[model samples]
Target: MPTEETQTRTGEAPRRPRIRLDQPLTPRRKLIPDYDPEAFGRMSERIARFLGTGRFIVWMTVIIIAWVAWNVAAPDALRFDTYPFIFLTLMLSLQASYAAPLILLAQNRQDDRDRVNLEQDRKQNERSIADTEYLSREVAALRIGLGEVATRDWIRSELQDLLKELEEQQRSVAKGEVFPGDGDRGRDVDDR
Candidate 1:
């Protein structure tokens, strides 16, 4: 136990000493409990937001409309991409190249955001734990101080005084001391 000296200021009660906050993190302090992803309820929300983007909708629509128009309107000579559809195949390959990377980029951004949020949560938990530990230490110190000042000596004195008074009363009763009375007095019938 580390002990320190303290004194009262004017008429105020004496202060209990305490350790400084600049000290390193200790196991006694804890903020948030263990984190569980299922308990956080955030995975579904992120997926929904990604699926609803305008860019995804636009790209899908353009691909479908272009395929239909090319089949219906192009004559044999006008069809630059014929039965084998070499040009159409190249166009699809180009789109896939860009689309696949864009999807990956979006996923990477989401992962970064999740990492940042998790770090924030962890710091908040640490602060909470430190605060809880500080409060517990202060409360324990107060209890110790109270115990020292509110001693049992006064209670013991009071009990002793009561016992002396009871002994005096018992002596008086044993002496058969009584005041004179009209022993022959009788009650009248129907007296209110």
Candidate 2:
């Protein structure tokens, strides 16, 4: 029940004035009936699409020609919108006024859809680029790791060196090249 003055008392924090739903300060307006805005927008788009077609143009032309011919040719008693065709012009003007707004509404909706689509495409492109960069980095790391690992040619060369040393030792033993522990020094010096 605080009034506006009470809500703004000095030396204290200002408080928001409370609204009473049961007793509105201003006269209440009648509630408007609810309707679907999307449906209305779709209907406007349909009308705008129809208005842009060649068939609509042909039909409008035929109607206007027939109206003029009838009004000019018919008997005076039967004719309406005679000579000046002011009524026909007024009708066309009214049609144009409604059509312009509907066409604008349809264009606005299309622009919104295009904007959303472009944003999604941009996000997709970014994800694709990130994935490509990650894969490239992984490939580079694998190449560097493989460079430090052993290769088939190095193992073959090491095996060949060990085989040559073993063959030299076998030849020396077959020729009776004895050491001091073998006790063949007397036979060795007599042969020499």
Candidate 3:
């Protein structure tokens, strides 16, 4: 049954529940306004760059000269700042204060980029070293394998030794004598 608290003046039923359990609660309003940090950082860097340029110095000099000249030469009614020029000093101080922080912010961002690049370079060097070690190991394995394999020179030397032994046996048979074994041949050579 519907109560007076649940029903609208003319509504049959509410389209949605009074409270939602699945969704997150709405955040309370804050005094500070929302802003993108990256956008602010980029804008500060641009300001810092402009302030660092010689063109900005030249323009600032021209403006100061113009301000002093106008205040000194112009009639009393037209002059804004007098001989003291307190307003000009305040403006310069204000600009310097803002510029110092902006320049520092730009430097911080550049340092972050440098750190990331250095880390990436270190990882690349490590990978290269690992790859080099792997190649060296593979080359060593191949060298060890090749050491056991018979070469053409070794095979030729062995065949020549066998041929000389066969020729010696043939010579012995032509003389109607038996050929000596390798041990007896060595003894016979020593005796001769």
Candidate 4:
């Protein structure tokens, strides 16, 4: 018995004795590089590092150092976040609170970008699938045309005539009977 592969362009399967499954044996998700949750998750460390710049570290260090220096050097009146280090402790606590959330926010933005990239990739894959289907249909049409041609003799005669014409053209070129862009003679033969 013939298989579906040998079927007509009309989408009918070849005559067979047995029933076939409607579903494909293996269906794959056309995973175009879309926003992968795992890929976005892995970028957390890098985004955190980028957002926690050298300037941020330097300013935080300076604030702590200056606070310490003022408390130690001042004669009680110059003390604001002073001696038993209440102000310093408060500032450090505040920094810690804000820093974690900022890093997380940066990661969230990166995740959004990854999601967009994935969506674009999926669209491209869909377009590719559409193009593939179109070409497949065209190929099926050509196959049907070849199948319907009733006379082998007519096809053979046509091919032989085409080949003879090509041979004559080649022989003319070899004998220098043709020249580059000599439009008149080429047009004359083409008309024939």
The candidate maximizing lDDT is: 3
Estimate, for each residue in 7-44, the C-alpha lDDT of model 4 and write its tens digit.
Answer: 77658856755555885666567768568766555565
Evaluated against the true structure, the overall lDDT of model 3 is 0.87
TM-score of each: 0.46, 0.70, 0.74, 0.44
Error of 3 at 172 (Å): 4.6
Clashing residue pairs for model 3: none
Query: Clashes in each model (backbone N, CA, C under 3 Å)?
Result: 2, 0, 0, 2
- lDDT values, one for every candidate: 0.65, 0.85, 0.87, 0.75
Give candidate 1's whole-model lDDT: 0.65
lDDT of 1 by residue, 128-165 (tens): 99999999999999998988774688788888888886
- Candidate achieving the largest TM-score: 3
Q: Considering TM-score, which of the candidate structures 2 and 4 is the better prediction for this target? A: 2
- lDDT tens digits, residues 93-187, model 3? 99889899999999999899999999999999999999999999999999999999999999999999999978877776566465356433433
- Model 2 misplacement above 4 A: 1-32, 165-192
Off by over 4 Å in 3: 1-21, 169-192
**Residue 113 CA error for candidate 1 (Å)?**
1.6
lDDT of 2 at 8: 67
| Position 162, candidate 4: lDDT | 90
Runs off by more than 4 Å, candidate 1: 1-62, 65-69, 72-74, 149-192
Root mean square deviation (Cα) for candidate 2: 7.4
